[model samples]
Target chain A: MEEKLLSGAELVIRGLEHLKVSTIFGVPGGAILPAYDPLYDSPIRHILARHEQGSGHMAEGYAQATGELGVVIATSGPGATNLITSLNNALMDSTPLLAITGQVATEAIGNDAFQEAYTVGLTMAATKHNYLITDASEIPQVLLEAKHIATTGRPGPVLVDIPKDILNQKAKWIEPKLVDLPGYKPTLDANPKMIQQAVNLIKDSKKPLLYVGGGIIHSKANIELFDLAQKFNIPVVTTLMGRGAFPDGHELCLGMPGMHGNYTATTSIQNSDLLIAIGVRFDDRVTANPKFFAQNAKVIHADIDPAEIGKVRDAEVPIVGDAKSVIKGLIDKLGDTKLETSNWIQEINEMRESYPLTFTQDEDGPLKVPYVLEELQKMSEDDSIVVSGVGQHQMWISLHWKFTKPNTWLNSGGLGTMGYSLPAAIGAKAAYPDRQVLSLDGDGCFQMTCQELITASTENIPLKIVVFNNGNHGMVRQWQKIFYKNRFSASELTHHTPDYVKLAEAMGAVGLRMEQKSEVKDVFEKMLEINDKPVLVDCVVDPDDMVFPMVPAGGSNDVIILNEEDLKKI
Target chain B: MSERILSVLVEDKPGVLARISSTISRRGFNINSLSVGPTNIDGRSKMTIVTELESVEQVKKQLNKLINVIKIVELDPDNTIESEVLLMKVSINKDSQTSVIEKANLSGAKSVDVGQDYAVFELTGTSKELKKFENLMKPFGIIEMIRGGRIAIQSNL
Candidate 1:
């Protein structure tokens, strides 16, 4: 084989291959034509999305699924601008993504020349780091650095703005030097002394509890956290972000605690003498009326971010380190020091037995959302990834879904951005082809990002989508029903929807809709039969059903509503 | 209460905002509004945090002990040199015009614009100097003031 030099565009394709980026989703334009020309013959498959936002989201999905850095390429101007929302999405969620965009020629930049804008400057606040490649020679190093930055530490989106001329310019390029960031070092070791102190607090306490959050997933510390909890024999309560962190069915696991969390979970936190908060940020949402949260508890927070140690609640034994490493250290120091919490466990069980998540309906009424989630859980594999759109569907999935592994459950917890699912599911499916990626979408949110189905179908990513179609923004409607005296207002959606099955067929995907309770399993089974393409299951759910045990905004977690009888039980 | 400056390096991740902010509140530490930016490193960030407390040293030591924290360097304002920049617009009257411009020159500041009613002066120096100048120019009639959030660099390496 003859050794040959490749152009900048060709080198980009080669670099993506080296980085193991198999998919490139974007919409092409004038400025990036050069790069797209080379993409055709390149091994990297390009997914033409309906919108640039969808492309960024697809890349985000890929990152979250595989734990690899996601990649997206867009052209200049409007093409670049369209990615802002998705970029912010990745930024806010701390997702690992690489967004590469074509820019005008270096000389033409700042002349207000055509589509030339300071893409790097424009994206400064939205990205971890961005580079404006004025020199074609810098592309390789920039690409490598972008990948490195996107995947390292706490993972975020990094952008590389390549000038149009640089992509077109031909030069004898020696490989750029690989530079080590001298200041970049993430600590993994937990100080043994501090770990022992924390363990002592737990062992000495009568009613110690564990408060888990998203940090467990972010740091991949679920196994370690579970082991520590089991060792201490402490009751566990999770924040909204920490749902599925522990097996929901685990004896020690007391569902989500905080505002809008279960009564038992919140009550357990309040009564706890020692709170072992692991990798959890006590957000105000999670600590509604924080003055009352765990009033009896002395917190021992172990988090990687030091700044988070005392932001919301004071920590008696604050261990600032990686959750996995710190928890492991705590376990080692624990060394079989089992604190007897039989009474505490009994109390928690009492709460669970009293105020559990339950809903009632007639045998012939509309489809219930919880049952849909339950059925989906039964149908999906243990390793399947579940993503949800915001609103009622998000709560249903969070409550019903039991996640066993890190990165298996994806939702916009912090930002709570609606219209998140369809695109995110596409991204997840692209990232993990072998694993089933399910998007649990609400009717309102599904419509918002439904256009991405075209991207999913065209790219041939087999995503399993379950839409809880109640024909309304069920959460807002529930709020209106509870707080606003059921005035309805603008919450009820009036727009008629396209027949989803026909719509899915139009996008080259298989769509199944279930109107009755009996039809649910068969429709899901039939959809699963088509493993070659994506499947959309639009289950018509009861518009009247609302998420139970919801703590109204700004209300105490203790102030919950669980139908009259359920309330009496608590 | 004594105050101290601690430079903390953290995993440049998104949720870090929650982690860092919550930590300060938990410790009963009042952060005087911090500034963060990317370091030379690919995925790491440096935060210049200001805290007022008697246990400044304790805060620094505890900060350095954090897992995401790569390093913590304490820069004392009393022992170390520091400066701040302000983009202030001052109202200039014809009667006190020359005096105001002369005062600006003496402070090593430059006036970027001069209008019939007002003028804007950009000053870069210590917070004390900026405050002193702002008081001195009050007689000339003050206009709107816009301050660029502080970016600090330790003078003594």
Candidate 2:
């Protein structure tokens, strides 16, 4: 028999436990202190993050690494406001995240009360859906709805803001079996007419290309995209977020295209006769100049969001439906279409060979970021997840790490939020204890959420955080060196970092530092051997390193700054 | 192509017009036309959007997923009655004020005020009626026009 007595906070915590949430990242404050009081005795582990944003990112990382929704709790006002960046990141990346924040009491709302912010309005754009729970009785339903919206179709973050009074009020906790919202229904089928139209266009084109994005991963349609690509002998180019959909090792995988993408990736799109875009919003980053993005290609943009179908470029055929369904339909209809085995493939191959991702390591200057990623990749499992903090390290991980599954590679794609990796790694490890969860972070991002390392150590979630230390926001410094005429504006950060080994020991975990290129392989081997606790590897890297082949944001995709030009020649 | 109904909730702010219309332009989903109005609450409004999508099933499903949209539902076209409201401000010669007022009343519109040289007329009904009123006042030289967004509700038995 289910008991019916619990405060809103208890209901929320109980519901989370029922939903199998073992860990929650948060910071206690005035409005949310009530919820914290009850959490002390709960089975759910509450991690006290130094900042609310760190907690938000931890939730995001966990959700992105594991398919399970990431849960974060924050107090009202600035705590809630700080979460905006992480929320924005989740929204942009379509990660499954659930963020619950304490709200000022109903009486104090709109009265400009302390620690009060318009969280609902602030998070509306960044969440798939959000609710402000004013009634304590509605807590169960709201929690259910929040998780449902978050994990359902093209997964994304959702928020539920409960006022302090509501959290304090006792209510009958009715754990409903179903959420019946008449207004919410997600479709997973392609529009037949649009599919037919797309099929017809693909059928007519000589050189068709499948431009895949993160949607393929979101829909778990990598097999389908790969099948369609091979079915039609089409080359596949992924956006930055869409990496890992097709292995770079595969000949069919053309590599990432757009600003900062490989030449072949961008050129393939330009030269292709027909472009079939799946589950990707053609952001300005992808299409620096829409006019030239697919100049010679007839575009057929397929996305679940109707508004994004042709938002950036003209679509010869726009299909608004789930990526998996649409791609399946296309594959079904692609029978007997003649394969165009043209030199377009040759051009792509030539570019890939000409501009491959590389880093020199001949007893080289500082530690190499790529070498660190390569070592980690070998040590990690195919199913293990890697989340990245924003900056040079983020770019390097996306470039060098070989991921094999959906949610295996998580990064703040849209918002580019820094300090996201560490906590997210902790969350991911907690969510899926069986899998290895690691945050490949930069020093800049590591410091941003390093306080959560203590959380990781205390919770005993065996998360591995490999911090690529360059002593600066390496990406911004690269930008300054290239674009801003080397005028570094607050791009450098310095604080006496506690000896990380002692720090991890202090926090009840393992910590190792790698100063030389040779030191990394041995240190990483040793770290992997000791899986008893969380580990942090402070990897010293080249300070002036830049993520090369970057077609400056808003610049032409075909135009790239070669790594040689940026590093060796310059 | 099939048709679908969508309910879009937007921040009731200026230039939301440009955002909505521009979205339509980008998507190229033919708008059969839509009706909108303010809701019971302030600073929030709803739109009853009717559009010809390639697939009714797909459109209905996708409409529910938009992050900016607060809520969406397919109105049973068989049972729901929809309407649009329109408002206009016209500057007419002082001598033609009486004629304009008479014309306004004939079009089921009320000339709510008489200014030094202009009159603001308000009308609530179908878009056809509003268009008719606009055409009737065309000779008087319309100075400004405002059309409320689309809103709809199911008629009770």
Candidate 3:
């Protein structure tokens, strides 16, 4: 708060501390080494990650769990480029992530010096906003502006590329203030007139369904969504990103709807007369051949980002606003009115009964992946945060887990990045040490970023991680089995090299292996009991088993493949 | 394709141009012509982009999402004063020199340079007029030609 001379690196650490940032994730290198010197003395705790990408996802995990800005730092060139995946992941999922990279000195920037990269150029499309700083005097304001931009109004990733010279430049320090961004104002509240029109459409519809997405969790509108659905007794179907936005076991909830969505959820979407979409982009995974998706439904789309409205499915009534404000507006304007959705609800319930999500567990066969998911969720507390990696296990968690609280379910939804579970779960545990954190990942996805388990162990962040090891890339084999005439090429994951139990022990974490379905409950119980360090469980299973109730790509929601029987019929 | 001109105002900063152009291209919209210049307002710039994509509304909305983009408006061709500068060099001898100069004068073009075997002329007008002049010089075997892309501003009534 005083006017004092400070180096650029000190200014950065001081500025972050001034902004109330207590934790950060990063990897140090030549360009970023100067910033690390100041960070050494700062009160902020910087978790050293093995890879820059890991640090970025850890930031994303922290941001999503706490509803705050997740910060990650790296050096230039390869270090900065490695962060592209995590930055893009945050961009797609709308997580507030701030990425700071150290560049070469100003004189060496254009000379192709060692570790110099055009980071700002490379990350232009990968971030929500970005900046390149060569002057030390701009550090304070740029730091403040970067955090503000990354955290507000349709949150996404922002980056600041600072030259190494700037990190050593001495400059007068002043308390940075947030200047209004004229071009960056976001629409928070929809027009009342538009809300009235949406209300009118809900009143006239014979069958109305609430289609929720991750935006509901981002906007903290779960209660409003539930109240609105309960008032009308409307059916609710959540997307993969919207898994925890609504309780899965509610009488009106039809579970997830999309390519791998439940049969009832998909059918209800096709048969609905009205679809009230909230905080969703109508991603192709959900819409599936947009022309044929929800043919009988008129859509009312609401989201914080205006560009998302009608981007995929044309919305008859577009409400451009945050989910909480729009849903609250709809609730207040509709004013305790109950709709006649009893017959509609009964029709969907019949469909739900005819085709529930089911898989047979053989007496002496390979461990079922879904069984592991259920056991983990059943053993853990209801409020335990769930994280997942991209593959069959990710879909299994979505299909099996019953999330009762918002922000409790985390995964790489839009980007679908593999190996996201371990570091992200560590991030969640870092944000909320009191809450239990469990991550479900596949054999293929777990190896991609499994090195981060060392960070968890060394940092003393205890996380229960389960790897459903089918000894191959499970999802690809399933697609090959169904569509590629059973020719499994490059799918075996090198015959499961590098024993996972040893890998866990080498990483300073407890290792548990589940080779049978009978060991699931005990393995999970023991995994939960360990609180001193992270624990990894490898549940070996059958590779032939695949995710069912799937609508093939470019197929209509009306056409769903129930099981191998349906595929054989094809 | 029905063509539309989008006039966009953006903050004067590095990488803003790349952001706008990339956003347009990634949306699968092809730009016909784009020109940028400093505006009267400090720390702000304006870009004139001509595209014939099916949905100008889609591109406009996408650009608005960029943090550097201040505002965007589609200019009405009827009320816009669109113009460009054209320079043309023609191969000419003693016989054709007089005739080329005559024709250039008829179109209000000024002869900027004259060589023993070639003549250079300069003109300013809308694309339609400059295109007509290009054709006229083609008969004389145009040696070279250059034209500044179109720029427009609304006519204040």
Candidate 4:
């Protein structure tokens, strides 16, 4: 067979196709034009985003929804720089993303030519690994290796910066080869000793609580986790990122635990005798004050990344392996030995009954965000995806919405990036066209990336964006009110707020506004009925409403504030 | 704070040093000294770093988390043969030349070059011995001095 010559640009597209990349989200510019020209002929569908950041986040949303590697491309300098936040978000959340940026011509790189940037240097810390391809011949191998690195072992964002000259240069395509990474092997199976130690802990503990995180969804270990939880008769408390990992409606579900989490979940963790921390990093949000967090509990931590095993709280039994494999090992090791925890379950249920998540609503007063989310949850199908931006509305969705499937609830749990819900919903909707996609966003968050709605409208992605309009950065305002002598500086957006309904209409989408409780169910139903175009609902929620049961910043989990009186006492 | 030495094996690639150093600094660990060179393995380099042991667990976990880092082994000073190389050009007068050469030879230093005004001597020893040698040479008006960071190998014997 004759060796066919292909340009570096064509090889990039070919590499993506070989990796089975069905879609990519990116924007085109001068330095990246060579690659974009060939993209026109590629089989992969390209989603043109209004901003580079939006494209990066859309890629994340796609990855989060589909459990596939999301790809994003951008030009050099500003284009690459714009992706820093999105990359950092993906890094913190362990989203599988591959970002390709175009550099200036190889000769012009160090000379600071037009649109040139040190993209590799910029993205080094934010990526799992990064590459600067100096030669055209290295394209195919580098791309394949980059994909492998991005999606494997603690999945994260990876960047490949190709110079313009390299993209235009011709190179002979060899058959795809295995990635040459000796230092990058991740342990996929838990060690037998560690698994046995964990099993012993499980068997001995009178009170065992399962603390699950996003890694369960990443590794698709929900079934194994559920099996372990049920067979051992242990109650489970999920982190914010772990919301959909276990069915929220399950009898053993203690709901999300941490800041803005339910009372039962946080208290149960604090009082448990043993904590089986699966796929969780013991983030400060979950741990609150490390000094007092799960102080009574002996931890058995299982994760694929060894770095997370003892990074925060020390684990008595540390298992470094894939979540699914480790959980499977635990299940196999137990061998039908049912641990007794009936009293613990009864105590947890009492806590759940005593401190159930609740809110007050007046018949004619402003609508509550939680009420809207609860109504939305009731209206949507069980498998519908709910993507949320950061703030009070995010907490509301996490608290009120019932997630029955894994990978169906996407949020910026680690980075807490605002304006994530809109573009993310677009990507999720694009990935699963038949499934309903909802963006539970705040007014402040909605304004940040409202421009991406134009892309949603133009691309015909029917995402239902429900703006929880509290007329301010609700979380910041709540914090200021509690901690900063009520000095609401630059937090309120009442006077300068744009009419989201009109804005959504301007972007060629159906716009609806609901200020009363009566309109909530009808508007949500109407929004769901519109399958031809995207819809934005400006839900006027009470501005004074705060996410309760918050463990104040730097405060211990035992110091949770359930109401204004609790704040006053503090 | 207790001082410790860490031997790290890393992929010999561009920007790895920066990656490791930045991660260390960002995590608030002050690196006292770091040295990097190619090892016996192909496409692999060894980095010997000395730092305080206040956050050894965090530092080790963070360093090990990096994809480029192949392995990390903490060398116990009590069980390892650690050495650092130092080169110094000392100002030499007739009065000080004989004394400096005598002290250098006693300290296992070899004269690399001798000039009209100064003589360059190369010394390799433990960090403590090198420090003592440095102090001894300082009185002779050292013109230039450079010391490599410590490197270690396990002593099976």
Candidate 5:
């Protein structure tokens, strides 16, 4: 075959095309304009985001929803800097994301040229791997390597910064091939001896618990996890990142186990003799005080990243591999050695019965966030992709909704980034044009990136966003009420501001308002019925509503405040 | 916290140092000494980091996670062969010149330059020896000093 000569910009487009990238979530700017010219003529659809952060997050949402590589692009300087949060969020959550940024020309670099920034320096800590391409010929190899690094074991965000001159320069096109990475070998197979040790521990354990996290979803190990739980009669508890990794209604499942987790899940972790943590870092939120968390348990942690094994809580039997392989190894080694768990199940069942995830509200009172979430869950499809911004609404949806599939529930679990839902929902919609996507956002979080509604409107992405309007930073206010002697302080928002419906309309989307508690079912149905364009529902709720089943920061999991009745005890 | 030393081999690429340093600082470990230079192998570099960390378990694993980092070895503080080089400029006079030259000669410090009012000397020694020499010159009102951070090779290796 004859050699192909292409410009650096053409190489970038061809590289993404060869990588099977169908859609790009990006914002064009001064330095990146060269690539946009090639992109304008390519078959790949580009969704022009309003902000660089929005572009980054939309890419994350697409990746999380479809388990594919999400691509984002930005220009240098402020554009590159604006992508820091989204990149950080992707790194924290282990999303497979790629960011292509434009930098100043090679000769002009470090000259402090217009729209110039040290993009590689800015994103070094925020991404899994990053490169600043000075040579135009390196584009093909960098793209392949960046994609591999971003999507492989313990997936994360990788960035490639191409100078404007490099983009404009001509280069010989090379076939897609990965450069030699001597230090980048990721362990894909679990050690057989370690798996046998884990099996022996499970066989010896009287009360075992399967503690799962986002790695289960990332590696698609939910089936193996479910099989292990059912065969052994062990209970399962998920982390925030592990929301949909196991069936929410499964008999062995105990929902999330942490600060806002249910009583059954939190208390059970403390009581278990052997906690098999699969694909989870023992985050502080889950382990509050490591001294008191799972005190009786000898943990067997299995994860793809060796660094996560003993970072927070030490694991007696650490199996370093991808989640699917580790769980498969456990199942293969265990055979049919089922342990006795009738009494353990009965104990946890009683905990569930006594302290269920419930809430109280008067029939004619202000709308409640949980009530809206419950109605939304009821009306939505079983496979609907649900997303949330940070704060009370996120917690409420996590506590109340039932997610039965992996990758269906997306949120800023690690970074807890506000303004994540709108752009992320747009990305999710881009991935699944036919499936329903609902961005359930808090008022404070909604106001942060509501501007993305314009992108959704212009792109014709039929995304549905429901704003739980409590007229305050709901979680902050709740914390102040409980921990700060009821002082309002800087936590309050005016009862009426930009008028969300009017704002939605001005942004070219249909908006509806839900005030009466009685209108939740009808309003949710109405919201879901619209399919022509993006829709937003402003739900005014009682500001005092707060998430329960709480473990005060740094407190033991055993010491949970179950409800308002327990609040009086405090 | 007890001090720990980490020896890392990494790809000699642009910004690899920034990436490694940021990783160390983000972990909240206060680095006491750090040195980096090209290794015997082409396209590879070595770095030595000393910090007030009780254990290098997390730090070592985190460093290994970086794609460019080739290898890491935790050196024993007591056993490793480590040295630091120092260059010092000192103010001098007829009264102190003789004592300064005699002491520096005894300590094996080589004079880089000599002048009527000042003198420069280069010294290579272990950190303890360097610290003692620093204290020795402190009394003579040391004008300026540049101390290379500690670099080490494992004794067994």
Candidate 6:
């Protein structure tokens, strides 16, 4: 076959096509102009975000929605620097994200030329791996290797920074070779001895709780996890990142267990005799106080990343393998037997009934945020994808929303980056055009990335955005009210808040504002009916309505306050 | 606190050392001494690090998590041949040259060069022995000195 020459810019698009990337999210600039030129004729759909951060988060959203590699592109210097927060967010959450940034010419890399940034150095610590492609021939291999690294073995964000000169240089077209990374081998199967030990622990315990995490969704092991739970008859409690890992409506589902978790979930783990922690790193939020967390439980951790096995709390039986494989191993070892935990389940149900998630609203008062989420959840389809911005609204969505499917609930759990939902919802909508994609955001979070609404309208993505407008940073204000003598300080946003309804209308989307509780259902139904363009609902919620069942920072799970009266006692 | 010696084999790539050291420091582990150099194998290097063992397990896991690190083995100080090289330039006078040479000889050191005002001596020993030798050379008005960080190899026996 006669060899054909192609520019590095063309190779980039070809590389993405080879990876089956149908869409990308980014904004182009000077150093990245060459790459954008080729993109003009490419089949890949490019989402031009208002900010680099938005693009990075949109990539994350796309990855989370569909278990595939998400790609983001940006220019050098300030543009690449703007992606730091989202990159860190993806890294911390184990999301498979690939960010490609344009750099100055190879000759001007270290000379600090226009739009020049040391992207490799800046992203080294924040990414799973990073590369600086100075040669055009390295483009094919680098992109393929980056995809491999980003999607395999405890996935995380990877970065590739290509200089402008390299993008312009012509190179012979060659097929991408398989990555030969000897040092990058990840353990994918649990050892037989470790599996036997975990099985022994599971069999011996009268009370065993399956603590699941985002790794279930990342590895697409929810079916395996669900099967294991069913076969073993073990109660399951997911972390915030693992919201939809197991069916929330299932009998064994104890809901989320963390700082803002359900009382039953938190207390059940505290009282359980064995904790089968699957694909979860015992983060500070999950383990409010590590010393007291699961004090009565012996841990058997199964995760792909060995480093996370005992990073926070020691695991008695550590199985370093993929979640699906380990769960299958456990099932195989156990045979056709289920552990007996009738008394434990009865006790957990009692706790759940005793301290259920509840809120109150007056006949003629500001709409409660929880009520809005509950109504929204009821109105949405079963497979609807809900992406949330970080704040009290996120907590409310996690607490009140009924997530019946895995990978349906998306939020910034680890980094807790605000301004995540607007662009993320667009990405999710683009990925799954038929599915209902909604962005449940807070007013404070909405203001940060609301500019992306223009992209949503222009791209013809019909994303439903619901802003829980409490006129304040509700989480910070709640913390201040509880911990800082009620001094609001910089938490208030009422003084300079945008008119979201008008703003959404100006951005060429249907806007609806609901101030009264009676109007919420009607307005939400109307918003959901707008299928041609995006819809925004500015819901006026009570500013003082705080997330309850709160476990103060560094406080033990036993110290969780269920309501305002419990808060006073505490 | 327990003192641990960790020997690491890594790809000879730029920023590998920086990545390892920074990761160690970021995790709040104090690197007492670190030495890095090429191994006999091409495109590979060895690093010897001495650090406190308060969070040693976490530190080890973090180190192994780095992509450049090929292998890591914890060497027991009692079962390893630990050695460090020291070079010292001692100020010499008519009365002090003979005494300095005698002291250097007692410490199993050799005079590498002799000058009018000063003399340079080279020594190789365990870290503790080097510390003692440094103290001995300190009284002789040592003008310039540098000690190579500790490196170790497992003893056959």
Predicted model with the maximum lDDT: 5
lDDT per residue as tens, model 3, A392-506 = 8888888889988888889999999998888888888899998999888888888899999999999999888888888889999998898899899888884257688899999
Per-residue lDDT of model 1, residues A292-341, tens digit only: 67777899998765656776787888887787888788888888676889
DockQ of each: 0.13, 0.16, 0.76, 0.66, 0.81, 0.61
- Tell me the tens digit of each residue's lDDT in model 2 across A364-479: 56767887788778877778788888888887777677655567777778887778788778777877887878778888888777888877777778878787878888988988
To one decimal place, how large is model 5's interface RMSD in Å?
A: 0.7
User: Model 6, B93: alpha-carbon shift in Å?
Assistant: 3.9
Model 2, which residues run further than 4 Å from truth?
Answer: A1-5, A17-22, A33-45, A175-180, A336-338, A494-508, A564-570, B1-157
* Per-residue lDDT of model 4, residues B36-104, tens digit only: 999998989999988888766677878887778988888887888988999999999888888889899
- What CAPRI grade goes to candidate 1? incorrect
User: Stretches of candidate 1 above 4 Å error?
Assistant: A1-5, A171-178, A494-496, A564-570, B1-74, B77-157
Listed for each candidate, the true contacts retained, as a fraction, are 0.07, 0.17, 0.60, 0.60, 0.80, 0.40
Write the residue-wise lDDT of candidate 2 on B68-145 in tens digits.
Answer: 445666777676676666778888786898899888988888788779889899998766677888899999989898
Worst 10 residues of 2 chain A by lDDT: A561-570
Clash pairs (backbone) in predicted model 5:
none
Question: Cα lDDT for residue B93, model 4?
Answer: 88
> Which is the leading candidate under DockQ?
5
- Docking model 3 quality class: medium
lDDT of 4 by residue, A1-570 (tens): 888899999988988888899989999998899999889998899998999999999999999999889999999989999998999999999999999999999989889888887888888888888899988889888888888888888999999999999999999887679865767888888899999999999999999999999999999999889998888899999899999899888989989888888999999999999999988999999888899898999999999888898888889999999999999999999998978899999999998888888888888998988788878888888889999999998988888888878989999999999989998888898899999999889999988888999999999898899988888899999999898988999998972358888889999999999999999889988998999999999998899888998998678898778887788757
lDDT of each: 0.77, 0.77, 0.89, 0.90, 0.91, 0.90
Q: After superposition, how far is residue A108 of candidate 2 from its true place, in Å?
A: 2.4
Model 1 has an lDDT value of 0.77
Q: What is candidate 3's lDDT per residue for B1-157, written digit by digit as tens?
A: 3878888999999888899988877788777778899999999999988887566778888999998999998988778888788899999998898999999989978999999999899999988899899988889999999887778888786
lDDT (0-100) at residue A197 of candidate 6? Answer: 98
